[model samples]
Every structure is written in structure tokens, then in C-alpha cells.
Target: MSNSLQYIFGGPKAWDSGLWTASDDRVRGGSSISHLYTHPTQAKFYGHLDTKTLGGAGFASQRTVGDLALDLSCTEGIKLSLGWDSSDQTFTLNVKDTIPGKREDGRDEAGVSWEYDFKAPENGGEIFMKWDEFKATYRGREVEDPEPLKLNDIKRISLMARSFFDKQDGDFKLYVNWIAAVKKDDNDSDDDGDLKKHALEQRSDPRPVWKRLFCGLL
Candidate 1:
């Protein structure tokens, strides 16, 4: 191993409830809603997902409050530590390279977003996703042969609980211990590296609690 350092994005000691906001299917006349509750040890994401209103299509997610100019160029992948998951439903993790401006009608203009969907772990574990694992998507549909993700300036991040074409719905809950960027080790092969465990212990930091981490942490 090259002994590269892992950069923290959202962790127990760094999570800020105000930094997460619900972005649900309400915009599409659906009732799906989600919330992110920040605790001392982890963050809880739970909500009721309704697909009836949208005719078997609905989604509820928690996204970063604002754009984050994060430079992940030095990192190879993202690491997510799972706490406890009540439902082993499929969830999506999204990263945006650019944020489009709002239209005159006060609605957001659609833009390309990189997304990676994974089945939530039944118990608790960690998942490391490489940059290539994310696919470019627009308005829920994958784009064919899209441009690469801008790793130097990651604009946004989101976690979503969506209805996979009406396959599943109802109440859902997910617990997350942390979200971080892992560096590529030198001994790693061409393929994704070994699934080594990421350190989960939250060490005591002496800095004042700041909600916006990208300002300095990145």
C-alpha cells in the first residue's frame, strides 16, 4: 500500500444537520419526502416513499445545501461507512460536476449528474466507489458516452432513496457513519483494489465545529 491519506467529507465529528436539505419528488407532484438527522455518531436518513402519485416513479433524497468546490483530483474513489440500515433497498449516490442556474420560472435547469446506485448493506459495512463507477445521468436517465466527471471541482453530492420502477416503496431508513475520499494505493492493480476496511473510529478534534467543511477541509 502507498499509505495515502483519506480525506473526510462528512463524518460523525463533521456532520452538520444544516448542510443537508431534502430534495424529494414533491417537485413532480409526488408525496415522497426524506430527512437527514445528524447525530453525534452518525447521520440518519429516513422517509416515506410514495409512488402512487407519480404512477410508479418517485424519489426522495438529501443533498448538500449549496455548491461545494471540492478538489478530489488527488483521490481515486469515495468511501462510505454504513452504520445501520433498516431496509436493504437500493440507494443512489450522486456527484455533480456542475450546477445549472435556475430559470426565470424559479425552477432549476437540468444538468448532467454522475450517479452510482448500490443496494444498501443489510447489516453495516463500508463501500468504496471509484470515479469510473459513476455514470452520467440527466433527469434520471443515463447518458450514452458522456463527458468525464470534473474531479477538481465537485459541485454537489446527494444520497437518494428511489423507487425502481415501482418495484419497491413505502418507509425506508439508512444510517451513515461517514463519507470520505480514499487515495489510490501504489500496490493496487489496474482493477478496483482490495476491499480493505476503512478506519471507523471518530477521533477527538480540537477545532470549533464548523458546518461547511469544504471551505477549509478540502
Candidate 2:
């Protein structure tokens, strides 16, 4: 019964507020971004952490459109259903092809950061992160033998809740219905004939939304 991996975002034709966007940076101890309702089905991504506000770590981001060819060993990465409220708050799943270099540009920030460490389960439950149990760190060291996670150069995908300046904070909450990029043959059996019909005959371009939004439609 393992055939349920096909969602680009939160579901139900989701696209009411244009995917998402809000990269807060209120000095350091930051908190100022919120979206509580947008539903054809369900969509709620919130942010707030003002340990005092200054400038060093504050986040709220969303980006897409960078599928250079996505195959990552037939994809078996990307799956998030998050929930948080205090527990100090921290959630970052940043995929990159470049977007690093801060500290007021002092050189030393080159991209490659995968982080997943969330806590808000002291009797409350629901926070699952699986992209092969993500924990990659590059440019800061810790990404050894890390390769299988290529949603094709994945330009950008960010969801962050951070407040690192005023030391720590308390008010933070997050919730997402669905988000998937996983494949990894999705429980392969060895018949190799129906990989989505050989990925739709390797698309010779018949214009089904430009072969599902451009990407070697064949």
C-alpha cells in the first residue's frame, strides 16, 4: 500500500498566496512574520521569535522553480509535517545552489546546509522529518559522503524559525499538512516498467504544461 508520494506543496490545488515568501531579518533576536489562514484545503506557516530583536538569525522563506532534472537516485528525500511551539524553536531545511555569506559579508558562507532539529513534544506530539533523517552541514563541516538528495540543483527551499541573539525565546508555532519530494522507487519491486510509465515516455514534449513544468520532457 505504498503509493502516495505526489505533492509539491500543501495540497488542494494550493496556491492562494503564491506559494510563500518572507525572509525576516529583524537584526538578530527577530520575530515578525505570520500567515495563519489560506485554505482551499489547508495552509499555515507561522514565524515569531523575538528573544529581544537585534539581528543575527530570523527566518521565513519559500522558493521554487529550479528542477534542473531531478533524479537524486530516483528521489527519496523531502518529506515534512512539522509542528512547534516553544521548546526554544528551530526548524531549517535549506537546500541550496548558492545563498550564503552573511556576518555583514565577511567572507565564509558558501551554501550546503541541511538542518532538522525540532522539539515541542512534552505531552504534545507531531513532528516528523525524514529525508533519510536529514543532518547535513557544509561550509561548516559535517557533510561527509552526502550525495543522494538532488531534486535537480534545488535552487531554494526554506522554512526557518530561529531567534539567536537575545539568547533564546518562547512563542513559536508551525504546522504544515504535506510536502513531498521523495521517490526512491517508492518501494521498488523490480519490474522497472512503470516508473510513472517510464516517466511518461521520457517526455517527447506534448505540452502537458510543458511536460509538467519544463524539465527534459523526454
Candidate 3:
């Protein structure tokens, strides 16, 4: 892993079906979201949003392995490749606190302590979500300027694509790959204590008598 960032998910393999669940019920006219086996190299997530439900509010989401530790500190943002089957949808990315329920395997939901989001416009394009542009919301309200990620404490990441306007009926498909955190070089300390101490002593602190004598001879 880089000192600044690390990869969490969205590699070449398809998602493990047992770990993913979908919400198809259109509460207030919401559309159903589901994943399909596209080809050996890609997985496709597609669904519709209801314009009639919640007065035109719609949401659809897909989640992956939540059991791994995510390090986000070295990144300025996230980078990913995206392509849509159409040209009229935008996607939102969300991270949540750990789910408390139990799955069939008898493990409780993982803790998701943070979140970041991005909007993918309908240009069949890719996006690099910048850290400054990422809005940090907790308990439903925005947190005013949070600290940079520590990368060792991430719980989960998610993606959602919805209709900007309700009653809009069109088929949408979003393909994703190479989703990762991008690193930024900051004043990070290297964890090597011996190296750091040696450098500090050599630069400013006084040398031992033998070393001083050697320097005198030189």
C-alpha cells in the first residue's frame, strides 16, 4: 500500500452475490435496482427511479465487501472508470456507519464511519472525486471540514444512481472498474524510528567523541 492511499474494491472479478442485496420497492414511486452478469470481465448495475414516490425522490444502491480495513488518508480523492448504457442519469456515492444486523453467516454488519459522494453526468465519462469536493455528513447533517482520511479506518463504500427528475422513464446502465483512492503527498512521517533518530543526531545534535575526533582529523 502507498503511504498516501490504498485500493479497497472494484477489481476485475465480479461481485460476490451473497454479499450484495438490492432494493426494488418503489417507495413513493421509486425504481428497482439490480445487478446482472454482463461478461467475464464486468458487472452491470441498472435500475429505475420512481418520480411519483416521495414527490420525485429516488435512490438505488449497491454494496460490496464490508469486512476489510480501508485506508483513505493519503488520497486527495477517489478515481474510477464509468460508462453508461444511456445519456440521462447521474450517480451518487455514499458511505454509511456500520450496519447492526446479522447476515446468514452470523456476522454483524461492519462499521462505516465515513462517506464521500460524486455525481457522474450523462456524458459516458469517468470521474475523479476530489477530497475538497467530498461532503462529509454524519447523522444526516454535514460535518464542517473533517480531517484527511487515515486510510487505516475506513469501513465501507457504496454507489447510487438516480433520476434527477421524477416521472423520467428510461433504461440506465452504469459500469464501474478501477475504483480507488488517489494519493496526495503531504508531510507524512516515516515510521522508521532508528532512521529518523540517526538523521536528527547527524544533523543537529552533537556527535560522540570518536566521531568528533574523526571529523577533526578530516
Report the lDDT tens digits of candidate 1 across residue range 1-218: 65344545455356788878898999778999999998766888899899999999999999886767665655787888888655778889999989888888776688898998887677888888888898998888899989889886787999999988798799988888888877655554332322221111112333223322322232
TM-score of 3: 0.60
Q: All candidates' TM-scores?
A: 0.81, 0.29, 0.60
Candidate with the greatest TM-score versus the true structure: 1
Ranking of candidates on TM-score, top first? 1, 3, 2
Model 3 per-residue lDDT tens digits across residues 1-218: 44233343455444455555564434224555555434444456676655455565555666655443443444567776665553346556665434446767754433333555454455546577775666665432467676554443455566655544463434556776546566564344345685466455445634343222211111
Worst 10 residues of 3 by lDDT: 209-218
**Backbone clashes in model 1, listed as residue pairs:** none
Off by over 4 Å in 3: 1-6, 11-18, 23-31, 36-40, 84-86, 100-125, 138-151, 163-170, 186-218
Query: What are the clash counts of all predictions, listed in order?
Result: 0, 11, 13
What is the model-wide C-alpha lDDT for candidate 3? 0.51
Of candidates 3 and 2, the better by TM-score: 3
